[model samples]
Target: MANTVNIKIDGIDVSVEAGKTVLDAAKKLNIHIPTLCYHEDLCVAGNCRVCVVEQEGVNNLVASCAIPAQKGMVIHTNSHKVRNARRHVVELLLSEHNADCTKCYKNTKCELQDLASEMVINEHMFMDLVPDKNYTTDKQSPSIIKDDSKCIRCQRCVRTCHDLQHVSALGVAYKGDHMKISTFFEHPMYEVVCTNCGQCVNRCPTGALIEKNYLDEVWDAIYDEDKHVIVQTAPATRIALGEDLGMESGSIVTGKMAASLRRLGFDSVLDTDFSADLTIMEEGTELLTRLKKALVDKDTSVKLPMFTSCSPGWVKFLEHTYPDYLDNLSTCKSPQQMFGALAKTYYAEKKGLDPDKIVCVSIMPCTAKKFEANRPEMRDSGYQDVDMGLTTRELAVMIKQAGIDFQELPDEKFDSLMGESSGAAVIFGATGGVMEAALRTAYEIVTGREVPFKNLNITAVRGMEGVREANIKLENVLPAWSFLEGVELKTAVAHGLTNAHQIMEAIHKGEANYHFVEVMGCPGGCIGGGGQPIPTTPEIRRKRAEAIYREDEGMAVRKSHENPEVQQIYREFLGEPLSDKSHWLLHTHYVKRKRV
Candidate 1:
């Protein structure tokens, strides 16, 4: 019956646990408190005083997000004095912000514009400072754009780059009005150590940070009579796409998504899950091969603790921060790229179409995929394998632009070639899913038996811990994998680059003894990716993850190697996993960058 503290917000009394901020209490009562810097994923940064509220007996209004609820505390969220202070804060931010809303990418979705309209601030209460700021926009990055003119000095992006990601690519420089977020020496984002993960874009309150959208280019390609556009939808995109399309969070729209893309005039609608299963086959074999060499042949040339290379953000993080460990990363391309290559080559040959006319587009839940698609090495198919990448949010816009009634759309299946997938591929959307999927296939391949887990679910590698470890013992192995018999395969999973940094540190200090590692660049894996729906909180991520597992359980085929299409591909085109053809199409290398 008793909580740690009691507080009154706008005459409504509510009890909350200790350490709960006033903002949290207000949320419990369904009270709205406008915020620019107060993001749930980042640490408390009271830089923007937009959430200021009146406190009884206090000389100055307190920032509700930074102030913890004390016992018997009285708060007024919309008192006359509180409104005036909050208004002034917005006015100051607007004066400095490039209030050119119509020309901005985030025009209708801009939080400042909404707040300005909500407050009814029709007149310019202060002199416009945009003309004097002389801010510059950096448009060099393939994945992101950093515009200083629209920034309100909220520091949400700062906290995300530093606290959540540990990649400090953006930080505060100078002081007061002269302050601005800048990379090392203010270099262009592409030239600096920025991973182009786009976490900052997700947290930015204004148009200061945004993904470099290729929607227009993709539209042009679709309209071209010579081009045959094929779109591949990522695993995570299906579960989260509904959130922005007027559907509930965690709604599995796989069938609906396929249907929508078909209606949108795509030449072909495929599944990225097909390549996801292909990745598992290749990555799992590579892991076992490395083990055979390191254990049987005593080869020191092979790298232990082989890291998964599916996440481009994690790959770039290593390229810049831990270049020496480049060899540790698996040589397999991401599911997106693998599909891209196969689309232009295998699919092209199968369909009797020209590879040059086959344009591959991806619907992914990552901004890093945009950068990954543009990497020179991705031209493994002899052309730009992936022509463009669209985030889940971007796809939702296209669905809207086409005026399709998404909720009423019927469930449809993907096209034949490069469209089939197993349940293992579906789990790639969640953290620890890669390790779990790899084990399910590798253990069977080595031991000739299913992995010793309940209902074929390897729960060890699944959860929300920043870093997790699981050790599986291989027993009763086949002749070729006898070297792995009685060997304990140690693997670790990490989501978010900060956790990846921690895991890498442990391996560097000789504290970790893992043989395999799985790292996803975004927190909660791709479900909580930077290109997911707006306001992607912890609860939404949990929902999306649950939807993924439910989808896996509902599938008839659960293992990667058991996928009929995968077996068919190996039998008809690719001889086997890690074959010469597979290597040429499904494998690629990484670039090492000097940490600036």
Candidate 2:
């Protein structure tokens, strides 16, 4: 499709497009080139010279990642010299690294360990150098853990924080061998402008950055016979958790996952998609009311540019990064939080169990969820709605620890009352899913007719795309006030904090305007969250996202407004959406945190 350049690697001639890096050309030709710091999603960092390749007529070896291929270039990828260099680099990294893999959390699946194995490096020949024990560990962060001892100074985490998430809470400090990664003034992660999105942990080659796990709390609760431990799974957890069970990356094991959790001693298993449906019902009504008021009066206190609150990562980003636009965020708590709240109150009441005695736990593919569950505003049910939050990875570990046969477990449905959900609710695991769910119901109420697309699955706003826009026309409705006719509802969706920052900047500078906006702090939504399975890549994340949509496709109902349980909830407890009682139990306010 574009200009091509011929390059020879170890006597094999290959034709690749112009502007292609040597790494790309080499990969296409099946040439093995080791790389530790070079990631496809991040900028080329030649800091780790593991990808050094010998080229004919060149002064010396060149980094394949940073150097572009030229016409008729002779590249020697598997030379003896190149092998020795890569091995030296690996050995040096191991010398400084904490080689206690047996005692380390990353033990068997670490990238550095894999690289050493690939190079046939049995042991480090150099004298072992102890890491700086005095280096500060940023345990202050609720969702993230920073251990400098495991950091190899690859700068992947720093780049990911700045280039991808737009939250540069970390950077490479000092210089040379003494150089280390640290936050501003060596302050703890939470104190800095860290969003707790976990992008850094996802990109880390080692266990330098990790999630603050609550697995111990979950185990203690499960062991307690007096406590009724119930687990609610997020939409994103089913697909990604499969990775840890030795299943394919994108496998949808909803049934297997449920059975595994049941075998783990949980009293009952529930689904967060059920609460996602409830969110749509409440959020859609709120949008309709706000639109009605805005039509009557352009300046309404309800606030314009309503941002989706499904992603706790984005919520924290708004609170810390864009505090000036805090009013723009919707009052809706995420489905994870909403489900926990209901599980403790509504579900407990129906089951005739004491709310305090019931331990409501959530299995999510999100690190930000751990922080969100502990938020002061999240406990609308009088007690802490969610007692403990575990990631998909943690759930898999627990399943393994319990010695359950995950593959053979039969599929099962979630508990009733708080377990019923629709296709729209299931999509909440993906980016812009909440926006699409809210739109489906809002469109129905404003038009007083069924949505044209009963599927209500807007493919336009789906995927890993940084930004996507769509406009939906509304039909018959009563106008509360004077408004312009032929007006279209403009919306924008941003998947990562990098894109989130760009969109926010455009809005603030009057460069772009939108009625509704959806922002998910982690790339590819919860499926690619920081607390998701290890070695999360673009390809694997896509597989997990596909599983989410597949679940939506097989659902009997697709709209939140159509969920029978949601309707029953309104009929029994709350009279209607946005009611005073509903507001008191469901809605909560945000507090601006210090950016410093």
TM-score of each model, in listed order: 0.98, 0.96
Which ten residues in a row are the worst by lDDT in model 2?
A: 477-486
Candidate 1 residues 57-157, lDDT tens each?
Answer: 99999999999999989999999998999899999888898898999988778899999999999997999989998999999999999999999889998
Q: At residue 62, what lDDT does model 2 achieve?
A: 95
Candidate 2, residues 367-392: lDDT per residue as tens digits? Answer: 88888888888788888988888888
**Roughly what TM-score does model 1 have, to 2 decimal places?**
0.98
Name the runs in model 2 displaced over 4 angstroms. Answer: 131-133, 297-299, 478-487
The model with the greatest TM-score is 1
**lDDT (Cα, 0-100) at 560 in candidate 2:** 88
**CA lDDT scores, all candidates in order:** 0.92, 0.83
What's the C-alpha lDDT at position 66 in model 1? 98
